[model samples]
Target: MADLYRRTVLVTRPEPGLSDTGFALERLGWEPCLAPMLRIYSVPMKQAGAVDRVIVTSGQSLEALRVALPPATPLTAVGARTAERARTLGFTAVDYAEGTANSLVGHLGRAGGRNSVLLATGRKLGVDLAAQLRMNGWRVTRRVVYRTEATESLAPAARSLLEQERVAAVLFYSAATARAFLDAFGEERGLLGSVRALALSPTIGRTLGAAPFREIAIAPRPEQQALLALLGPLPTSDTNTARREIAP
Candidate 1:
């Protein structure tokens, strides 16, 4: 029999690339489904609190704030794309770092003394940012301005993709997204064992906790393209990567 997955993939991107990735996967002879496990919603201004600066680590989070906040508030973002989103959303003075929490914090250090900083993010927010900022003499606040809840039901097409065993690989961009994907399958989560797991960061891979899979590739960076590139046809030589033991 021929290889089951010559080319089909299921992508669990947060909320950014549904069309483009679908096109790419189509070109690769794979059926791509936009099983957006997490949904992004703007934090209503009525519920927002006072803050001097807003820190955005993801473009989606930045976009959510854009819809909720007015212009002129100083915005600090994680990457170029996030900065661009902020600018487009009416924040003229946008400061963005090299695209990670540590890098963004480092960039903030150079600017100095913002007094109060508010982090707008989803539910699963537990990074070492607030403590670091507090130690540095800045009052930091975490306001779950928005949330990305896992879809209760996968799209019919996505279910077919998973149930048919046509999925060759699954890409996880964030630890939260990975959890959402795992939850989407519920009790049948083991079905995912047949698909290779790809993660954008080691943080995401570690979240897998040894899920039954032969290969789990971690992208060096958080870029979508980089993550996808790592997923490109697994090498056809002596396999050096070890199998991940899925924890129950």
Candidate 2:
């Protein structure tokens, strides 16, 4: 069994997601230190008119929309989680593709008959989706429904773990989050020599740039479960030993 401290991981996703991933890590017997690198803010947007369909890339976009459109509006989501969120927000017609913008674009391409589509997304994001859909004969209207800003610094717990060199890995969910983390801690890249950098996608992994991590691994799929799988299973004996010491 690895030492308790050696099993620690730094979670760099923003809240809601941060808590969810941390809880999953705990269930897998890994210690997770919550460290949100980005702050998400809802950007109020006005829908000029109704559209045939709406596309959402993240749950944050749906939350920002505030269900302004009718509940029966046909919605296409980038992933199952976003589709679930759309349902929770009262949208009756919802469907999703594999967890990536490219997959969503392909899914729409295969669906035939192009129509006016509203792309609900974060500020300065989703350009590729809009462009691809337009190329495929869909009139796409892109709306910035939310904005993400980099936090000023790492959480105290995350900083302490890095300083002690106890963190085994750092999980990154988005390129924005990874960039935000770099903005906050780029000067200390050397500290990551013994830390593994785990990213949800290749794009996110590339965002880490030249950070001297012991290794950098990208998830096979752009989903939380795939990202967590990169950490492998924790030993049962270590799970019990760490649980007793770390339990609140």
Best lDDT among the predictions, by candidate number: 2
Which pairs in model 2 have colliding backbones? none
RMSD for all candidates, in order, please: 6.6, 3.2
Indicate the residue-level lDDT of 15 in model 1.
52
Q: How big is the positional error of residue 93 in model 2, measured in Å on the Cα after superposition?
A: 1.4
Per-candidate total of colliding backbone pairs? 3, 0
lDDT of each structure?
0.68, 0.81
Which residue runs does candidate 2 get wrong by more than 4 Å? 1-4, 110-114, 240-248
For model 2, residues 14-128, the per-residue Cα lDDT tens digits are 7646777778888888887777788888888776487888898988888766557778888999998778877887889999999999998889883356488999998889998
Where does candidate 2 have its weakest 10-residue lDDT segment? Answer: 239-248
Candidate 1 lowest-lDDT run of ten: 239-248
Compared with the true structure, model 1 gives a TM-score of 0.78
Per-candidate TM-scores read 0.78, 0.91
